[model samples]
Target: MDATVFEQIRLMLWDVDGVLTNGDIFISAEGESFKQFNVKDGVAVALLAKHGVKTGVLSGKQSPALSKRCEQLGLDIVMTGIHNKIAALSAICKELSITPKQVAYIGDDVIDLEVMRHVALTFAPADAHMLIKNEADVVTQASGGRGVAREAAEHLLMSRGLSMDEVYKPLMDAWNATVVVQ
Candidate 1:
């Protein structure tokens, strides 16, 4: 929508299933469900939080695993079981005391379109539905659950003048040091 709005985003709201996962629903006979998350995406989320760029997840479906992951990442906000994401987005923006121009939302399906229309910057995975992709300001190179989150994070970080290498160097060095000790 607004080109200037993208430059002013201080918060990012993300959708889970299609944006963080591959939109696959794996269910066990016992009614359990599972999804895989990307390590790079997790790192990106952590880096965003460390850099004071708030991050959160809003999922239409309720999943305990998603809540646990958000908790571990120290996300600023997380709202699940949200069938109407536009309402959730509205509440989130109001709670954060930020205008839509200061918020970015990433989604991958039709349900996400309404929220997308209201945010400053909207993102969709490369493999997202055509309608969703058409409405996105940024269409990630990677598919959902396959590093799309990381890709979007990288874009936002770069836009905000933060470099991934600089942010991760200490952690990388620490791992390298540990490996040498072992």
Candidate 2:
């Protein structure tokens, strides 16, 4: 893949359950009970934000837990409960005043294909569905919910001439800076 391709990415959208949560949704009688998320992904989103890449989730399903997590991430785009991803993505692009050629989408399953094709770049986690991985422009080494976002973000930044140290130092510093006063 050309480094210039990644340089054009202004918006990086993610798919929630599989991409960020290891694809295990715990359902209860009440409904949409819970899902586990990796702290590494949280750090990934924060890193993208600091580097001027808008990050967000576009899930076919929606739940309270998902909403809360997006809020904590401070995502610039959050469009869950989305059935028609292409339409939703179009709206998002219009809202952001960016063309599809300036967007990158990371998805882990079949549901994400439509939107992925419309974006400038497509990424899939190592453990993503075969169909998705086969179609992705980049198949990250890390599995879903296992710091794939970090890997993807690192790739994007490195394309822009940033070293690994330069990419990770702020992530480390930000975590260290959140100390609580005793």
Candidate achieving the largest TM-score = 2
Looking at model 1, residue 131 earns an lDDT score of 98
The clash count for each model shown is 0, 0
Clashing residue pairs in candidate 2 (N, C-alpha, C atoms within 3 angstroms): none
Candidate 2 minimal-lDDT segment of 10 residues: 173-182
The TM-score values for the models, in the order shown, are 0.85, 0.92
TM-score of 2: 0.92
Error of 1 at 142 (Å): 0.7
Per-residue lDDT of model 1, residues 1-182, tens digit only = 44456458878888988888888877888653667777777766765655567888988887767777777666788999998887888898899998877888889999988998888898999999999999999999999988877788778766655577866655466654432110
lDDT of 2 by residue, 1-182 (tens): 77788888899999987788889888999999777888878777878876788988888989999888888778899999999999999999999999999898999988898888888899999999999999999899999888887788888888888899888777667766753111
Q: Tell me how far the alpha carbon of residue 78 in candidate 2 is from the true structure, in angstroms, after superposition.
A: 0.7
- Cα-based lDDT at residue 31, candidate 2: 97
Misplaced by over 4 Å in model 2 are 169-182
